[model samples]
Target: MAATGGSGRSTVADLLAAGMAADGASAVVLDTAPRLTSPWPSWTVGQEAEGLAALPPDRPLTRSHVRHAAALRPGADRPDWHVLTDGRDWHSPPLTLPQAPAAWLQLAAIGGWQCVVADTPHPVTHDLLQSRCAGHIGLTRSWCELPYAVPVLCASATAGGVQALQQAVMALHAEGMPLQRTVAVLVAQTDGRLPAVARAGATMLSARIAAVVHIPHDPHIRAHGLRTVTRLRSRTRHAAGLLFHEVLAAAGASWGTPLPDAPRPAPLAVVSHS
Candidate 1:
């Protein structure tokens, strides 16, 4: 997962891992971000940070080493779900961006994990997009970040968002990113129905990407903080599931089964707000 800061990349990564694990797949999350917090709440109290810090800087990382360092998620139905994150000040010099991908690849090899969700740092570069991961999920709170699109999840939906999405999609295509792999996730931040502007924005975004998944805002996520998908609000969980399915399909993951097409929500007509 890649996105500009605060685009909810970590949350999405957590959800994706949970979804995979719930399906009986062995999944792991590698947090390459600078924070000390574990995106997956279940592993927060474990020795995850220490495990990552113990990785030998001089030797090639292996499955055995990773397993030794990874912290397993407690209470998971599947015993294989785990997480790894660097402890603050653990490495004399923290792992650089170039080094992070190699570490992620090494961890992916271990335990024959079915999915490896990497919560990468912000401003995802072209090289990261082309990295040897199963696929990429890009999150953006604004349309301007569309140029970095890779099965993108746009977190906002407004009139301005609609215009920005169009420009972003074109910019992404111009920059050599495949638009077919793009997606827009319009997040409503309140309990009421989606605003007309947001609904219209979703329609415009859908025209340019593989799918547009609307996530109804859930206060529970904010109140309780990040946790397993099973603990999230029903609406939020359903939306995340849809987003996960769309992303996997866009990435051409063999594990993804075909989902039947459902009628999209009616798009509220665009209107001037000013």
Candidate 2:
């Protein structure tokens, strides 16, 4: 979850999912943003594919539905990560997006993918302020509480962003969220020196979380959207790699010893082969 808008939430999500897939981990990205604004589920299996709206939670989720709703086109070589998001066009009137609980219900049906990288809406801290406490914990809480979930909290490496993140961390701690297993990321806006607030924020917040990672500014990402993983600079990639390692370590801490891979039925090839 992110504390503010433009906090590199999607950038982190893409990096984690793509990195996992490149390492042969079964991973998928769930984009919890609207089609008009989201950068995921760029395309689907067919022109008529309706993304998550087509894969309703009323029926059990299957590997076929998972792939069909994903961004992949038919017969395309499976890329490192697959995206699931609202695929509807701009002309269409907006439909009510699924809440985190409903999205989690749909997630429970899928059998294969080992990791789900969720790129959620912005200003989660703001939302909590307006929402009911107990009922609104939603995916932010559900996914974190999982046996092997690794929560990565994001905020822009700015003074306001740091303050927002601190508020969120304190609120989550109050709500019994797993701060120990959480990884905090500060997305830097420039290659120049980080603000005193950013540095001090990291120092102040270090004791409350697993570890903090800072992503250096990448000109490529600023010019173009986060599409090609190779475009990331060496330093940026290094940060991503470190972030991935922290995520793995945190997830490992959740389950202690690694769990054996669950057996799969023949029909579901690698959790619905692309």
**Best candidate per TM-score, number?**
2
**Candidate 2 ranges with C-alpha deviation above 4 Å:** 41-50, 72-79, 108-111, 130-139, 259-274
What is candidate 2's local distance difference test score?
A: 0.71
User: Would you list the C-alpha lDDT of every candidate in the order shown?
Assistant: 0.56, 0.71
Pull out the clashing pairs in model 1.
Answer: none
Residue pairs with clashing backbones, model 2: none
- Residue-wise C-alpha lDDT for candidate 1, range 1-274, written one tens digit per residue: 3333444556666666666666666778777665443454343654444556667655555567777777665433334467776544433465543343443554456535656666665544333344424254332222223222235545544455445555556656655556677776665656888889878777766776778777676786666656543466766666766776777777563223443332222323545568
Clashes of 2: 0
Give the CA lDDT, 0 to 100, for residue 190 in model 2: 82
List the candidates' TM-scores in order. 0.69, 0.81
Cα deviation at 198, candidate 2, in Å, is: 1.1
lDDT string for model 2 (148-219, tens) is 667788989998889988999987787778888899999988888778999999999889998898988899
lDDT of 2 at 150: 74
